[model samples]
Target: MLLPSRPAPVLALALLLPPLAAAAQTPMTATEFEAYATGKTLTYAQGGTIFGTEQYLPNRRVRWAFTAQECQEGHWYEADSQICFVYESESDPQCWAFWQEGGRLKARFAGDPDGTELTEVEQSKTPLACAGPDVGV
Candidate 1:
């Protein structure tokens, strides 16, 4: 005769542990939000290194790097969209997107091979000078 196994309790404990740990964490602050927002240049390193610099505007919105090919005009955003940047593609106009998750900045390129990815670079908190009439937070 074979001995009975006791693995059911161990399996149940493993399944229930992570969710309990996650629920104990606190939400991030506004200052923390801004720091993560203007963190660093998001890059694609697979093919050739394509760099995109990001900065917080005076209006609390974010701006990204502009290039002649991928990004045009260096202005990036249009006034009518209220701050959303447009991503251009050969097939159709793609929406340039960004958001914060788990206190990190994430970006995505539309119609591109890669999906949204977390930036590996650390964010710095050095204050930037305001250029126009807009106010700071």
Candidate 2:
């Protein structure tokens, strides 16, 4: 008696899917992002070097500071499936696509997957430290 053979094409397709699925990361929706980031401070790195840190506050407000720099106040909103931020220092909106991977947030500028990518290095519940205006006066 001859045994039935498995579908070769189906098997091949299944084998090819795992890597593709893993590579295709889905961007988080606005609700998911807010729930994950609110009341948290996240530090991001680019090219394995520290880039900046952001503290997420209620009502979509945020505070961002570069390494050892003064903080800037901003607010974020969802636009065209991307998170767009407007800072008090700059009126132009800076947009990014955010996703969760490895239990941390990953962001790409302008939703460009091949462009600059920032990886979250640390997360905390502590608020960001912002020095008062005119320090060392």
lDDT of 1 at 1: 6
Model 2 vs. true fold: TM: 0.78
Would you list the C-alpha lDDT of every candidate in the order shown?
0.35, 0.76
CA lDDT of 47 in candidate 1? Answer: 20
Q: Write the per-residue lDDT of candidate 2 for residues 1-137, one digit (tens) a residue.
A: 00012211223333544556434889888999999999999998766677788999999999998777778898999999888888887767878878998898987677333345678999999998877568878
User: Best-fitting candidate, measured by lDDT?
Assistant: 2
In terms of TM-score, the best-performing candidate is 2
Candidate 1: tens digits of C-alpha lDDT, residues 9-125 = 223333544555423433334444445554433432212233334455443444343222222212233232222343222223333334455655443333333232223243444
For each candidate, give its TM-score against the true structure. Answer: 0.34, 0.78
The superposed Cα distance between candidate 2 and the true structure at residue 99, in angstroms, equals: 0.3
